[model samples]
Target: MEFFFYAVPSLMIAGFAAAAYLLVRRARRLRRTWTHGLTAEARCLRMFTTAGGGGGDTSVHTTVHHVYEFTTREGRTVRFEEENGPTTVLEGDFVTVRYLPELPQRATALPPTPGRLAVGTGVGLVFLGIAGSFCVGFILLVHVIFAESDGLLP
Candidate 1:
């Protein structure tokens, strides 16, 4: 029981930290690739919106998805579809895309956005808040238990 109290909280903290680390790592990598990679104009072939997550609520949040195609430096063409957040890219619009020279498939139509960073930070904060609550509860419980055992509490 004592081991569980410490081990569970430790595991939860580690899990949250690892998730945040991965999110930050991926965002950094995407930003670096966008900054250093080759850029080209891609034509958006189609655009669509899909409702995400929410159901039974009148206000359903939707995400815009766009399909784009661009010709690489080597004369090869590549097509990719990605979520464009709230901004909608119209079909036939020539949007800028950045891609690696060696792996053209690793590309993004937009630079690294702040949404991922914000989400990671929010998750970490929420985890910390929960862990802090657990810690406070544990400390209070230990104090009460010890006081009662010693007959210090009337």
Candidate 2:
């Protein structure tokens, strides 16, 4: 019980911190790629759908996957599957793609929308909020447990 109060929060804090670090690293890498990457019009080849709902016409949750094809500056063609969650860009649609010039295979059909910085900050705040809530709840639980054990609470 004693270990539960302390160890759980410690693990949660560590996990959240690690997650935040990874998120920041990824955002930085993405920003660098976007800033120095080349752009091309990528054509959607096909879309695959995975349905995850079964309620006899009541639940209709589905995920759409897209495969895009684009050409590099060196006249080589590349095809990639994009993991766009719940958002479907129509097959045969021409979308702007960003790729590292030297490594054209590292490409994204979904360029970070215009306000990328703002979006990153917003996501960070949401994660922070979640972590903060867990920390606060754990602290309160610890305080209540200690207080009751000492007969401080009626």
In terms of lDDT, the best-performing candidate is 2
Largest TM-score belongs to which candidate?
2
TM-score of each: 0.62, 0.64
Report clashes for each candidate as comma-separated counts.
0, 0
Q: Candidate 2 lDDT (Cα, whole model)?
A: 0.76
Please list the residue runs of candidate 2 whose C-alpha ends up more than 4 Å from where it truly belongs after superposition. Answer: 51-62, 74-77, 85-88, 136-154
Q: Across residues 1-154, which tens digit of lDDT does each residue of candidate 2 receive? A: 5657677787787777777777777666567668888889999888888887788877777777888899988899989876652264788888888888776776877657648665876689687769867886887888787778883433
* Structural RMSD, model 2: 4.6
Residue-wise lDDT of candidate 1 within 20-42, one digit each (tens)?
67766667767766678899889
